[model samples]
Target: MPTDLSPVDDALADALDDERTRQRETLSLVASENYASEAVLAAQGSVLTNKYAEGSPGERYYGGCEHADAVERLAQERARELFGADHANVQPHSGTQANLAAYQALLDSGDTVLSLELRHGGHLSHGQPYTMVDEHFDVVHYGVDPETGRLDYDAVAARATETEPDLIVSGYSAYPRAVDWERMQTIAEDVGAYHVADIAHLTGLVAAGVHPSPVGVADLVTGSTHKTIRAGRGGMILCGEERADAVDTAVMPGCQGGPLMHNVAGKAAGFAEALTPAFDVYARQTVENAAALADRLQTRGFDLVSGGTDVHFALVDLRETHPELTGAAAEAALESVGLVANKQTVPGDHRSATVASGLRIGTPAITTRGFDAAATERLADALVDVLDAPDDEAVRDDARETVAELCRQFPVYDGGAVASA
Candidate 1:
């Protein structure tokens, strides 16, 4: 190995190298995560992070604004083209940050906001009692139908009429089926509420033409570039030209300080890559893999929320299959096999966040590594086997071997300009 590390930084460099090797050897199945291409990674590591342009392009609060202006402009333009929105602000640091900005822009303190309940299928930023959303705004919780484990739009409408919230928040972290955004917007409008859609998990599908888009339907749309978009870790707000200044100002002065230009640059690179024909293929395959995994899990007697998935991730209800094992145990067992996944809370779950009753699986990372339906089936088999035999070392070892074979068959690394570097 070529050694250029100084003595003081050598230990840190070695640890980073170990992590890189681990990523190359194992699978990363985290739903909110994806592997970036070499080009995107390189852009994120560029000199851009040194600049501190506190405001939008062409009107910065600092010197040497030309390049930062270009970077931010590229990100904004790509967002507009990808989502067909009138304006885009690529400033918020993450999905939650974007939601905070949207809330700041549209609602006042104590204003009621209707959102999916966190334990049922919503993000904490939507309004868990311990979060800032809950502290500053009154939250009206909606949830999936008790029988179907799907969003009860009728109930949501009824709740909206009763709460008369200032904003109706749509989109979800664990919903398997699509939300009726058109109807949702109508309900919000009738209740005199602003409709905001957080499309963080489904953005890439919308970009790839595989999933329905809420871009033109919702008054304000926010999403993370990292999830389905497969960009660097950051958030963006897309809205109409009428709401541009409000959204921008809220994100800038009201919420965060100077933007992380490196993240912004990576967002632009990822957005550019998302617009390509090959990325469209990848996005399509992502859904295909997810659907296959859900189906196979159901076939193996594990319950899937909402029947199955039409997106990149799904929730597996473990009550029937592993009735005695907690979600945390199942998650750990799967991890021991090198099949990465997270414990999640299912609707009607008796368990809380610490030991929930569901598992969240996504196909983005495996799909990005070129795995498809067959690979998803194999992954599902490994998860089911591990969960079934949580105490069996032999079962764990076999699953690990299977995972290794899958990784070997579908190797992934940063593939653009940075590959050479």
Candidate 2:
């Protein structure tokens, strides 16, 4: 499929081919990235992209939406079944869009919002200053405990009481531990605030029942399809029947226009795959691999946020064991040896976000590549070797060799060919 592109547009196709080569060659530790299946890829690249279904299934603003409506309804049904929610909106273009819709449906223009601080693992859509959310709503923030690197529920409750916010947002972008949805719901209820759970990173884990779900607990649930869910690249919102019309209206006429029907097809295809027993095994291995990675890194003297993880990633605070090393430097050193990851800010970190004091390493992509705990540990050791001697070309060379061996042993696609149609 990749080869077919060159005949139409050589330059664009070559660029895509290069990206395909890079993915097959390097190791991805990015927490939010995952490889969709061949069926999903095909569905995303199908003729459905030509459709303009601007409204919900069975009701479109344009003509010739029969098949589009069918696909959208299938996606909605699969999403509802997968997450066990009463209503699902599969038209959002991204997670942040879904969040925007939730806000539109639940909050007034100047309503107060309480969410986690970005430096301590909150998403920008959760009211980071200068964003649309911050401009429209009065946004306040809570932080993880500096000492334990975990959420302080009591502190959050106190903050909610003091602020008297209209809505409270749970879920995170880089946090490694599990969240207490019931505690958060109680806090919001006590303060007369709506609860919105953005489980963008936890969708697949929750669907497989490997992690706690917020579908029935929170007032609204928002997530991205392509993270751990591997349901192509889009956003979704799940809510009770009472709020279904508001959510659907906000997503369509309120913010977004025509839905991305091709991505919807991809979502349906991927969600079908997710319903299988094999996907459950994959989700379990993903978490187990993360635990193994965390344990091995800690044993190698790296200090992790909360000292461990209960999810598909680990946040390594470089301030302790590697006092002189910045997360950016560690990321570059690892990338030099073909390991791809992102730098992040740890709790109490004063460093700028560009050169953070922590690394957010994840197992979702690698686990999708079929890695076991033994393989994950081996990769961790290679990662440490590079950090232990960043200036030494010999160390990087050895690490690169290890990455090549692992990539060859577990090719992302059959025969190392990328299936991007």
Find the candidate with the highest TM-score and give its number: 2
Write out the backbone clash pairs for model 1. Answer: none
Candidate number with greatest lDDT: 2
Runs of candidate 1 exceeding 4 Å displacement: 1-8, 414-421
Scanning candidate 2 in windows of ten residues, the lowest lDDT window is 412-421
lDDT of 2 by residue, 1-421 (tens): 4646767899988998788788888999999998888889889999998999998777888999999999999999999999999999999999999999999999989999999999999999999988999999999999999899899999999999999999999999988999999999999999989999999999999999999999999999999999898887999999999999999999989998999999999999889988888889989999999999999999999899999999999999998788899999999999999999999998889998999999999999898887899999999999998988899999899999999999998788645422321
Worst 10 residues of 1 by lDDT: 412-421
**Tens digit per residue, CA lDDT, model 1, 1-421:** 2223657699887887777667777787778777888777778888997999899898899999899999999999998998898999998999999999999999889999899988788999898888999999989888888788888778999999888899999999988787788999999999999999999888898888888888889999999997777777799999998999999999999999999999999999999989888889888888889889888988988888888887788898888777998888888888787887889999999998889999989988888888879878988898788888899999889999999998888876634112421
Candidate 2 Cα deviation (angstroms), residue 54: 0.4
- Quote model 2's TM-score: 0.98
RMSD of 2: 1.6
